[model samples]
Target: MSLEAEIRRLRELDWRELDIKEAGVWPWSLQLICCLLLFLGIFLGMHWYLVSPAKQELQRMREQEVELVREFRSKSLRAANLDTVRGQMEELEARMEALQEMLPTGAEVPSLIDSISEAAIDNQLSIDFIRLRSPSSQEHFIERPFDLQVRGDYHRLASFVADVASLSRIVTLHDFTLEPGSGGVRDLRLSLLARTYSYRHDGGGT
Candidate 1:
């Protein structure tokens, strides 16, 4: 049929006359429009039910892969620096050993006290008393405190203190009190607390 004739038929034909039983005889324009609408609905339904979920799952996996790659890189970097880290740890251990040597052991306390007495005598200081107190327990070491009282001139007392400090073993002096001695103004009596530390090898406090 001519295009003009078809258009005229469509414009003049329909009023409430079209029905499903007469679908085969429907005008071509109407039938084509219905087919296009049905195809569009099917395409939209398939995209919503099937394609959309699959796309979401694919995106999630890609994100997970990125995180795994980042973790792998971090571990690889650590492995590459392993030797340097070990060297640093060994150096720290050597330093700790050196420090531990300066601290006297439990067996060496008596000798350390004798050394202090000798230092006082060497500097011409009269030793009034040298009393060892009970060792105090610390977190990582034991503190061995002692009380020392002596009578001497100012220069001699200073020399004795310097000698004690210069010993190979570590000794810290505290609570110093100096008063006039019985002899004269030049003679002074000094009282002080001396502390030494030893490493705690065992878990129990000594």
Candidate 2:
């Protein structure tokens, strides 16, 4: 039959008189239409039940892979600088040790004061006083001040100051007042302050 004849026959068919038990006797066009509809339903159902979730999971995995790659790059940069970081740490440790040596802790103050007296005597200066004042505390160190009174010629006083500055221990001189002795003599009565610092430790540290 022609396509127009098949459509005319489908329109003339009496669905009210169709027998459910005799579905095998239905028109071939009607059967083809039902099969196509069923196939489309199954395809949509399969996509919703299976393919959709699989696609979502694949997308999530791709995002996670991107994050992993970024982390790998960051760690690689840090690994490349590991030797340089270690060298900087070693240099800092050496500097800390040297600074600690320069600033001795408690009970070593007297020996340091004695060293100053020896320096003055070696430079031909007379030491009248080497009085240690009360120590002043700071956030990270302690400052111990000493009042030094000496009398000598100009050259010897200068020499003594230079020697004190070059000591193995760290000492800084400040607040100097000079008085000239009487009668054409170059004797200088020098009074000055010397300060030494020590590192402050946490919990009775050295």
Candidate 3:
């Protein structure tokens, strides 16, 4: 029908009196309205079920790409500085080894005692005794204690201590007791605690 005829039919018809059971017999105008409504519902359903989830996934992938780019930049910088880092590590290890050499092991204890005896003799102090005590535990090393007794004048005692400190192995002195010799002997009695350190490792001793 012509557009004028269709418009006239729509204007003359009463929509409220339309028969629901006989939809096929409805006017062309009402039928066109129903088709348009059906098409709108299908479009909205397709967008929600298919297109919306795809758009969300694409946004998540874009965010992940950005994080990956940052991670790559950080690793590239570290790789560029790898040689310098390795050099520093080697220097630190060499210094640590030198420090370890200054520490004596269990086998070197006797040699250390001999050195102390020589130092006292060089200072003209008579050696009374040199006694080794049990090792003590410390944080990074073990402490070896020694009890030393000597007979000497005041100046000779000080000189002996200085000689002991000059040894290749590291040693520390503590807890000194000095007494004047009895019966006008003009000699002094010197007693002191000496400590040395040994590196701690997998082996229990040394």
Candidate 4:
């Protein structure tokens, strides 16, 4: 039929006369409208139940992929510099071992004091006293201190300090004091604290 005829038939149809049992006899326009509505409902239902969740899952997976890529790049950069980092670590360890050698062991401290005395004698400084103080425990080493007093000329006293510093073991001088001695005008008395260290082995000072 023509479009105008269909429209006129739909407009002339009776109101409140439609029934399900009489659907087979309904106008063609009504049936077409119902079919279109049914198709639209089915499409909306499918999108809500199936396609929406799948889209959400796909979006989540994409975000996860981005994070994984970032992590991979960071790890790759570290891997590329692995050899250089290892070499630096090894060099540091070697220097640490060398420094540990400079620190004397507990048993060698007496000999270290003897070396100090020899330095004083070599510099023509009179050894007034060279007494050991109580040892102090540190986190990774033991600090052994010596209270030293000597009498000499100014030049000799400076020489003795330099000699003590040049010893094979690490000996640090602290708290130095100088005063006039009773002997003569050029006489000088030197008093100082000398500190030595020993490495702690097996969590104990050696």
Highest lDDT scorer: 1
Worst lDDT 10-window in candidate 2 = 197-206
**Candidate closer to the true structure by lDDT (higher is better), 2 or 4:** 4
lDDT of each: 0.94, 0.89, 0.90, 0.93
The residue pairs that clash in candidate 3, if any, are none
Residue 58 of candidate 3: its Cα lDDT? Answer: 97
Note each model's CA RMSD in angstroms.
Answer: 3.9, 6.2, 5.1, 3.8
Candidate 2 regions with alpha-carbon error over 4 angstroms: 1-75, 203-206
- Regions more than 4 Å wrong, model 4: 1-49
In what order do the candidates fall by lDDT, top score first? 1, 4, 3, 2
Candidate 1's C-alpha runs over 4 A off are 1-42
- Models 1 onward score TM values of 0.73, 0.61, 0.63, 0.75
lDDT per residue for candidate 1 within 1-206, as digits (tens), equals: 88888789889986598897887888887788779998999999999999999999999999999999999999999999999999999999999999899999999999999999999999999999999999999889999999999999999999999999999999999999999999998999999999999999885667
What TM-score does model 1 achieve against the real structure? 0.73
lDDT of 1 at 59: 97
Tens-digit per-residue lDDT, 101-192, candidate 3: 98898789899999999999999989889999999987778999999999988898899999999899999999999998762566999999
Model 2 RMSD in angstroms: 6.2
Clashing pairs in 1: none
lDDT of candidate 2 at residue 84, scale 0 to 100: 99
